[model samples]
Target: MQNLEEAELCFPQLLNISCKKHIRPQAEAMFIYIVLSSISLLTVALNLLVIISISHFRQLHTPTNLFILSLAVSDFLVGLLVMPFQILLTEPCWLLGDLVCALYYLLNFITLCASVFNMVLISVDRYVAICDPLHYPTKITAKRVQVCVFLCWGYSVFYSVMFLYDNLKQPGKYNSCYGECVINIIGPADLVLGFIIPISAITILYVRVFVVAVSQARAMRSHIISVTMKHSSTVTAKKSELKAARTLGIVVAVFLMCYCPYYCVSLSLVIGSSTEALMIFVAFFNSCLNPVIYALFYPWFRKSVKLIVTLEILQPHSCEANIL
Candidate 1:
């Protein structure tokens, strides 16, 4: 009986002060480790490819790609810094000390916030580009994008600090026992600030962009001559519709799909539970999905990946290669 009890304790030496080991099956734990580790590695690798693709290929540089690069940087950090720590959480106990746990949560807050904000920025960028194409060049310049990216990150840090203020002040205050790492997040505020605002902004902006795009498509078709031009005009009109649909599908649909459940779970105010972990992981999976979508939507990304994998970028003045 004593042996069994000791086995259940996270820190056997602590006796009464120790947290109990998580009561998951060995096989299940291994399965989770394998899956999450694979995701972490894939996230890191894919986001790294995006970072290299944008930074190395000179012609690929643009205001839009700059937002993507900022996103890749945040996603890259999520895979590198946050995911591994999260995986560690699936273990028997939190071996890392209290301050590390607090820091980990802080980093997680920053990255997730940065990702959502970056998406908003991307949505606004597209809105301007599509709805006001005439002013796009003058309005959404590279320098302006750089400033937005900087502010996005800065706000992420500020938001994180405000969100986790109490816990940051007293790391591990909510831990039930010595070997546990738990945090108490400020409520309603997380749901409102993190979920409602950003999601609403993205949805509204994308809806406007879609409306404009469809109208433009109709206008183009109306002006199209009805001769040999008919077939080509129809093709162009269809492409416009397809592009608008795709933007909605990828940006809004995927974002809602990934984030909704997590926020729904958060609404219940259940933090630091197995169910919460599952829901949060679903949200983090968005980082992994981002690069996949990029590869699908951006031809330059595919071309740049080819050049990068071939190591052709090592050649002299390879940045000048016109992948666009």
Candidate 2:
């Protein structure tokens, strides 16, 4: 009887311990889901607003602005369609069934690759225009820009198809946490080809771009001083060029601030395990930061926002005037 009583007491203790262990993981998962969902929603809304403002304003439709719009579109889709699903199904498993999981992963890969490729194209465009102004129009013609954009999408689709094929063939072979869609082991090859290579190329291109821009700025400054006593025409042209360069600089700065840490964290994940969660968080934060940075730092975007607000305010007034 004494032995039976001891066993009964111990059984309750064991059950309690087991419950606590399971509850902790559940709570942690819940916390992560809530935080990630909030971030995703905020990012999606911001990007959507930017896209709408740019699309509605005819004046904001330059080639550079078009590229930014494409980026904003990609970010918006990812935040709205991908991140929420990921946060909600945090069991490290693909809970949305196989077909949906495959599609989601494929879209994720394509958008991410497209984002990186677009950044490279933007950097190259800036470099050519700033460093070789005489040939800018000829070298970066509208047709050439269209070709570049098409090629970016083509490469993104190709890579995504290949990745999807491999993932589908294996199903859950390389997945972690049983039936999950995550890469069980993020190899060095994956890191290099997927992120590091493109990031390095972008960094080199931007470095050259910076050097050319600085030289151009210095030359413009000297010209302004040399022509200080002359007519204002040359000074006005130089000032316009300076303003354009300043705008480009802001764009590059925001791009670097948003992506540099993300790539660094991703590359580090290839070498260490201590930073897995932190790196994931940093990468996720990149999508959210881009729209905010644009709104805060880009005058063109700010002007668009003002125009949108003004139009909204005027619509009712115009309607009332007509009614009157």
Candidate achieving the largest lDDT: 1
For each candidate in the order shown, give its overall lDDT on alpha carbons. Answer: 0.86, 0.64
Per-residue accuracy of model 1 over 1-324 as CA lDDT, tens digit each: 999999999898989999888678889988999999999999999999999999998886888779889989998999999999999987879999999999999999999999899989988887887777668789999999999999999999999998888889999998889888888886688879887989899999888877887787787668666536547865664564446446534855676798899988888867777798998889888889988987888788899999999999999999999997
Candidate 1: segments with Cα more than 4 A from true spot: 226-249
> What lDDT is reached at residue 86 by model 2?
57
Poorest stretch of ten by lDDT in candidate 2: 15-24
TM-scores, one per candidate: 0.92, 0.75
lDDT of 2 at 30: 78
Candidate 2 lands at a TM-score of 0.75
Off by over 4 Å in 2: 1-30, 92-94, 175-179, 184-186, 228-274, 309-324
- Candidate 2 C-alpha lDDT tens digits along 104-161: 7777778777877787777777767667766776887767777788888899888777
Model 1: lDDT equals 0.86
